[model samples]
Target: MRSFLYVPGNQPKMLASALTRGADALIADLEDAVPPGEKETARHTVATWLRSLPAGAPVWVRVNSGPDGLADARA
Candidate 1:
C-alpha cells in the first residue's frame, strides 16, 4: 500500500515539512485547500516547491478546474 500526505499549496512551512513525514507520496494541493484570495500565491508557492525538489521526488499536484485551473496546470 502507498501512503500519501497532503500539504496545502498556500502554506510554505507546511509544504516544506511534509517531505519528511514518511509518506510514500506527497500531494501539494492548489484547489480546495487554498482560499480564493490566496489562489495565485498558492500557485506560485507550489510551483517553487516543485522546482526545489530533487529529481524523482514522489509528488503530485491537485489543480483547480476551468480556466483558472488551466493556469494552475501551467504553473
Candidate 2:
C-alpha cells in the first residue's frame, strides 16, 4: 500500500520538505487548513511549489469548495 501525507498549502517550509519524507504521495491542502485571509496567498504559494517540482512528483491538491475551489483549480 502507498502512503500519502497532508501538507498545508500555505506552508512554504513544509512544502519544500514534504517530498523528502518518504510518503508515496502528498496532498497539498488549500481548504480548512488555510485561514480565509491567506487563501489567495496560499494558492500562489502552492502553484509556485507545484511548478518548482522536477516533474512526475506524486502530489495532489485538496482545494476548497464553491467559488474558491474554482479558483484553486485554476491556479
Candidate 3:
C-alpha cells in the first residue's frame, strides 16, 4: 500500500527532512498547514523541492482552497 506524508512547504527544514523519509509519496502542504502570509513562499519552496526529489518518489503540493490556489501551486 502507498502512503503520503504531509509536510509544510514553507519550512525548508521539514522539506529537507521529508525527502529522507521512506514514505511512498510526500504531500508538501501549501494549504492549512501554512499561514496566509507564507503561502507564496511555500509555493516556491515546494516547487524547488519537487525538482530536487529523486525520480521514483512522487511529490505533490496540497494547495489552498481559495481561487488562487491552482495558480499559486503552478507558480
By lDDT, the best candidate is 2
Question: Alpha carbon lDDT of residue 5, candidate 3?
Answer: 95
> How well is each residue in 4-72 modelled by candidate 1, as lDDT tens digits?
998999999999998899999999999899999999999999999999999999999999999879999
Error of model 3, residue 47, in angstroms: 0.8
lDDT at residue 48 of model 1 (Cα atoms)? 96
TM-score of 3: 0.83
lDDT of candidate 3? 0.82
Q: Which residue pairs in model 3 clash with each other?
A: none
lDDT of 3 at 54: 82
TM-score of 2: 0.95
The Cα error of candidate 1 at residue 56, in Å, is 0.3
Cα lDDT tens digits, model 3, 42-71, are 888888888888887777778777675876
How does candidate 1 score on lDDT?
Answer: 0.93
Error of 1 at 10 (Å): 0.2
Q: Which pairs of residues clash in candidate 2, taking residues 3 or more apart in a chain or in different chains?
A: none
Ranking by lDDT: 2, 1, 3
lDDT of each: 0.93, 0.96, 0.82
Error of 1 at 21 (Å): 0.3
